[model samples]
Target: MKILNPAMRIIFLLSVLAFGIQACTNNAKEETSLKMLQNKVDSLNLFVQKMKPGLGELMTNIQLHHEKLWFAGTGLNWKLADFEIGEIKETVDQAKEIETDRPETKSLTMLSEPINAINHDIENQDINQFKKDYGILTQTCNTCHTANHFEFNVITIPSAPTVSDQDFKTLQVR
Candidate 1:
């Protein structure tokens, strides 16, 4: 049997060690690049999901809530108005949550004060005050539309019933 000398054995061991280390280095580089690409794809998928509602559906929601608020407040149904204002605020908050990067999203934040005013009127059960504050709220909506280049989408003090299924009259005495 032939046996390697000490110096040759040392060289053989070092070569094998170096080959193993190079293989590990290549594997690490490939894994890191693959992970980076996967992370980007995941982030993009999340963003697309957030944008799924599109602008038309969002605008429709705001318009529907506005119409319901109008009917409730005008009918002197303060409780219904209160419920609707909460829905409106929550819908607006959802808009901000999902579309934080949009300029129109910032404009929606302008409704906070008007919403608060409407809330106060509802709490007081002051029909006249509610009507006045609701006008301001409509104005804010129009202002937001104008600022966002949606001036064509003018919102007004709703006078006619858009939702016929629900009674806006106060059914129960508070």
Candidate 2:
């Protein structure tokens, strides 16, 4: 068996000690980086939690869009009707995402059929069909409200434009 001399033994021990120190330094750096990433994630989560809208707020937006849709359809403004329906669908989608914990969110699926029918009526540009489909949509909204124990919030066909500033009628280009 060959024995390492004194100088070689000291060199080997110092090399091992240096390697150990470098490994510890690398571990410390990794831990700091992980903690920084965790802090960023926590901050983003808090921001999103604060920005989330309540279910009632989303429903109120839907209600406004529903009224505007009625006016647009009755005025034979298919484009505007389509836009309103899109807005309603968007708000409903947002509700589904942000209000996942709410039981009422589960009833939102009931609106899909009626909404699709309304979109079909809009595409055909048939005011009569639009009115009928609009009625069905309103009824569906009320049905959802009833199922969610919010029966008092009944939705009905709008008798007049909710907003007077904007004309529901389509402007013809002369």
Candidate 3:
């Protein structure tokens, strides 16, 4: 093989060095950007932990889930009804957590039976049974509200479809 001249050798070496330096710079920039993103995520998480959500917000979530549960169970969408029931139960648990200072409402004992009944009805794909249990659930909610001096916060079955965005039909068969 022919030998490269001194100038050509120097040029080749310099090119390799320059490429290496650029690669290192790019890696540093990427690492710095990753660190910055991680820092921002950590900051946001800290802020969220510092902020405790109020009872009203949690209760509103429960109400929305309740509505969805009603539509799902009424439409004979058993899976959706089950999902909504789980969400409602979770929201109620979250509300109880937020209201830890108040001991009396710690456990939604009144809701347990109705919730279980609804779950059983959904499992059996029994719409009529679900409706009957749902009525009992609504009455229980009203009773709880009255006991808590929130009698004005009455819940009732919807005459027509309330949530228009979603199709309350079974999406897929499991």
With a 3 Å backbone cut-off (N, CA, C), the pairs that clash in candidate 2 are none
Ranking by lDDT: 2, 1, 3
> How does each model score on TM-score?
0.77, 0.90, 0.66
How well is each residue in 1-174 modelled by candidate 2, as lDDT tens digits?
149888899998999999999999999999999999999999999998888888888988999999999888877878899999999999998898888889788778888999999899999998888888888888898888887788998989888877889888877621
- The TM-score measured for candidate 2 stands at 0.90
Query: What is the Å distance of residue 171 in model 3 from its true position?
Result: 4.2
lDDT of 2: 0.88
lDDT of 3 by residue, 39-103 (tens): 99999977966697777777778888888888788777888899999998887777676667666
Colliding pairs, model 3:
none
Give the residue spans of candidate 2 off by over 4 A: 1-3, 172-174
Candidate 3 weakest ten by summed lDDT: 98-107
Clash pairs, candidate 1, are: none
CA lDDT scores, all candidates in order: 0.85, 0.88, 0.83
Of 2 and 3, the candidate ranking higher by TM-score: 2
Rank the models by TM-score, top first. Answer: 2, 1, 3
What local lDDT does model 2 show for residue 25? 100
Best model number under lDDT: 2
